[model samples]
Target: MSRTEQELRQLYASTRGMPTGAAKFAVLEEVIRHADALGLVEFAFDVRMSATSVFQHSWAPEKAFLTFSWCLAAYDREPHRFGSGHEHTLLWQFKWMAYSVYQYPEIPLQRGTDLLEDMERRYRRGGHSMHAVLQNRGEAAQFTGEVERAQAYYEEMALTRRDALSDCAGCVPSSQVQTLVALGRDEEAIRIGESAVRSGCTEQPQLIYSELLLPFVRSGLGERAVEAHRAAYRRIRDNPHHLGELALNLLFCVHSGNLVRGLDLIERHLSWLDRPRTPLTEMEFAAAAVAVLSRSQEQNGGDGGAVLRFPTVEGKRRPDTPAAELAVELRERALGIAERFDARNGNTYQSTRIRDWMDTGAIGEPLPLSVFERAANSRGGERLQRLLDQVADRTAAGDLVAAARTRAAAAELMLADEQYAEAAEAAEEAIRELDRLGLTADAAACRWVLARAYRMDGPGGSGVRALRELLDSDPWGREPQDGGPGVSPEAPQRLQPLPLLPARPELEAALGQWLGYGPEAAGWSLAAARGFAAAGREEEALAALGEALARHPDADAEPTDGVLADLLGETGAVLGRLFGEAGAPGRVGERGPTGPTGLTGLAGPADRAVSPTVVVLIAYAEHLQAIGRLEEAAERLRTACALLDAHPDTEAAGRRSTVLTDLGEVLLRLGDVAAAEEFARAALALLEPDDAWEEIVLLGKVLRARGADEELAKLLTEHGLELEDLDD
Candidate 1:
């Protein structure tokens, strides 16, 4: 080994069992510097891996940022030397870069963009790159507010995983979940997340938990949120040293109304705060602590003037301290940390979060006014009422957009306090301002609040009538008027339809009117179809699907185009499901055997792109399976598997696995038990442990049917499945 490599190995061995802290990180910094002096390009990966441990344990965003920068610098010096095996390392660095940017919101956008450009450049070199590069790129785009670009990247990543059938398939799905959530596709995000979990992709429990919690809570799926929290706690229970994860869990607990448990978590993890932390962690910790403290004070029947006590450095709690005194103390501490971070690192995303936290005395941006509103609504008393009044005062001085938003927020507070008339009036005022400002989306949101307030007031069809009127007012769902204030001419066109309100019946009714009209006609149709399916109106759903299919008949034509890929995949999947449900006994796109059209028409193109070809083949195979053409279905799956295997650039390992799973099922139906077992086992090997459950169940059934009880038992044991559960 080279001297740098030898030193790295030595350090790794020395720190094998040691807990991460400032001392270990200090040594790592020196080692990285020494490696840089020696021009050890490969050693960059080693340095970064060690730094990642420190970042994870210490919650230090600076450590993550520095590590990624160093690694990227090494790659820049000698990009040619680093290839396939090293791509994962580069991907890891870039992922952390995005994470650091998110955690430290003051980080320069240019820095993140530069890193993303580098990754893109590397991937463009026509060599093997890790699947995670796409995910990292998406994350970077998301951090930079390039939502459309981010969505495209995330969709491509998902498509790549579906096509590739690679190991560790959970990563893409997990990323897609978050991206979908950010795009306001909360229900879809939750659906994707739940599917991944069911498929056994629970490796990153903390991520899964955090990502799923928000959407579930927003959608009022309390039981689901509790389930996610429990899973998160179970995963991190033995590894409580990760302060960031602990802080995130604490925040989730507080948000979910488990204040006592939140306090217990804080007390248990208090020692972690004493360790080295980046400004990001400090901000998160401070926010979580203050929220818990505030909740505790409310629970104790303490008014706004009541003093709040905190655990001392030694973790001893004092009962009587003024809340304002505590808030000021915490704010000062956060400011001091942020200042130090800014002085050392020249400002970062964390600084922005810290500033927001300090200014609002809250946990999150867009501010957690919901907490205060909840307190007041629940009769927690005068202090929260005063806070609401202050918000009203700010609204009076703010500009149009800000003033409108403040009113909507005030409306929420009023509604929570059961002041329905005030809520309605506030919402109406906000709606008028937003409408005049040409903020259609914002106006729609305000109308939703107003409608809710009307509903809560009882009797009369006022709420429904109000919603119907709002929908009618914008029948075509037009975009905000051009040249309107705050409407940028350069903004990307809307990627998806404006999300419908949570009121399913209203949304369904509005969607019914929008059929085959407007720019988002197909999207609206799909939403309606989903709503119908969820409501068990299968025939209505099928009819809606037919309308959507007619409107977007060319969805499968350009699968390589990032914008169209997700649409095509989703449409194809929906079509396949509907066809299966209909029990149709015809080939896909046959049209009475008058040659192919729609998705099937693209299947045999000699020059078809690999992604589109795979998607079309899958849809065709699904149709064949639904029509009892087992042999044909297997053939298509095998072809897809061969194509995926032959093209590594497509990174279709995940897709390959899907084919394998399907082929196994088809072969089993054909009574070819041995081949089915082989294919199923291969698919299971390519999938993560969590994702292998279904395959195990499949193979276990095959083994049992053939009276191969011993082998079935062995398979269950190897995959951590219990025979008893299988029996159940």
Candidate 2:
């Protein structure tokens, strides 16, 4: 063997019993890099083997794609170098291709089928061990929506398996179970799975359990479904990397009313879904998370909306009741994941399906504004109009709660469209209905809308008055009177506090009373700070932000804290403006009331256990930029870029693109025109055609400065972003 081959073999042997994670992948990557450098003919085969190991452990689509692409390329260049193991390698290659086709529909099915056919032709040449190849072909057929062909292939494998000597005997039963399930032979599938489990032939136990879960659940065998779920969970518990199996188990948990367990699994593993390595897996994870949360909402007697407003399950809690707060947190987290995925990937068919599920579930919620918001954001006017019509229908049908929510949403949409009169009318109707329904929380939201409408149109004070009433009433803490007009046994006794109403001094004072005390005080204070800032009361905004920072000291530790990050960013801007107004010295370590020019005092805890997030870094940079501290700002932007590189998720990618553009602008100010242009071009390349117009405009400026007018004009014309629109 060549020295490179020896090294590769030694590396693989060293990782034999090691756990799957970054460490294992790190070693594998090193071996692949070494193999590539040596120009070995076995490079493709080596990568394919490593890719199989990764798929078995992590199931990361991007990782698999990288290795598989290399393998295919190498095979094309030197097919003869595959040696005696060529047939086996071909089998595995085709199998992986089929798996990829199943996972990512974006990969055309014909490509996978063509690979499978090639493998079958090779198998026919030697007539040796075709069971595994045939079974995989069945899977590819099924994934491509060719059900009959898949079944035929699967049956052929089943018949051949008894006489064939193959290591994939266990896989045959598992495949058979899946085919049976797809054919609506649930009983047969369950029987086969159960028999395999009992006979000790379940080599791929996770697959068997996954196949059995749906059939058992659909058959109303909750106990059996639970058993399958537990088994599947245990099989993958150590790795916790099989997205498909995890999602299947989650579905069973939700469907069988094991919501607490489902939630636990989600909380434990949801963070792993952050990488967006595989669009299909990410989609599945989001769908499963949303489904679980929706079921939990229903079980708790709340509407199954993406936006969760309720605090308790069934308006009552025994000492044994699970924490409803955790459930709400999970629901919010799930919604965030779905939203981030949608933002990065845009609207794929899978994403749209998940969105539809959320929309349908939102109809059952106290407020369906989330659905309306999504429709408006996506420019799905037909969906918004349909929802409006539904609101009207609900009103005519006297479903007051549904009508009120839909009307409020309609009002928001009308406001967005700048139809102030229509917004006012809709908001008023919603408020009236909500008030009559005794939905204090819902009413408060509608009142806020009405207030905005009033402010925009005729009487600004009406909006302020509405906000004042909401605050003074302390609706969230109010007790329901026995037999009151708007009270029902099922109605929540205390209203959940509404998000901070549009910033008025009156609203600020009310929020202030809860500062450092209420459960939501930090959020309230942040809102108050935003209000004060908007009203040009910088000092008050700074004070409110101080209070917020004191309450949520660990903000930087939680990268998912988008709200807190925004608050911090806004506060940084405020502080920067204050520093600028006072004409402070341009020293790097200049101190303000908040400790440093960069708001370093806001960094939580003494050990600084976690580094500041990209959000915090960018926000601090923004503050520096606002105060004319260009060098410090550029350094902070570099830090943000590093953070983005470390965590290459969809959300991080979006942030990276923004930071690049910002960095380019900073570089331009520093007279590094060439470097700035390069950064701008890189940012442009990272962005999708439909990405934020702001980023595009920033990059356009760089291109314009460099006299790349052709590229600039092409970008503008392609994205339909006219120069006049940019000016607006």
- Best candidate, TM-score-wise? 2
TM-score of model 1 (CA atoms): 0.40
* Candidate 2 residue runs with Cα over 4 Å from true position: 1-14, 40-48, 65-82, 161-167, 198-203, 303-728
lDDT measured at residue 249 in model 1 versus the true structure, 0 to 100 = 64
lDDT of each: 0.57, 0.57
Q: Count of backbone clashes for each model?
A: 30, 1
Each model's TM-score?
A: 0.40, 0.41
Per-residue alpha-carbon lDDT of candidate 1 for residues 1-728, written as tens digits (9 for 90 to 100): 34556766666555544445556677777677777677665675666766765675454657677676665676667667766555556654555565566545456566666766765565556453545667777766654456678889877766663223123545566767767876779898887777666455545656666678767776877767766765565455334344555666666666666654565555435555555355556656776666666666676676653432232333244554565455556667766666655554544544565554333322232212122233345352453365455545555676555545555565666677787755765666565556556566656666767777776663344465565555555533555443322232322222111222343534654543433342245555556656565664544554554454344424222234332344444545543432332323232322221112122222122323456455645655654565576786787677667666666577445777777888888898899999998998898888886867667787887797689988988887887777665562
**Residue-level lDDT for 641 in candidate 2:** 67
Model 1 lowest lDDT segment of ten: 592-601
lDDT of 1 at 386: 52
lDDT (10s digit) by residue, model 2, range 1-728: 34567767766666654445667778777777777677754753666666565754464645765676666666667767765465456455555555565555455555666766776675667676677677787776654445677889877876774323243545667777767776778988887777666445534677788878778767877656655665565455434456667776776666555554566556446655555445555666666766777667776687542232221222332232233444455445445555554453344433454554333321111212222222344342664576666765676797777666666666777676666655765666566556556676666656666656655654223344444455555554555432222233332111221122343544554444423342245566677766555564544554566566545534223334565566555655543433333223232133334433233332221112112234445555554565567787787677556545544653445677778888887887787878887887778777775776666776666667678879989978877877665442
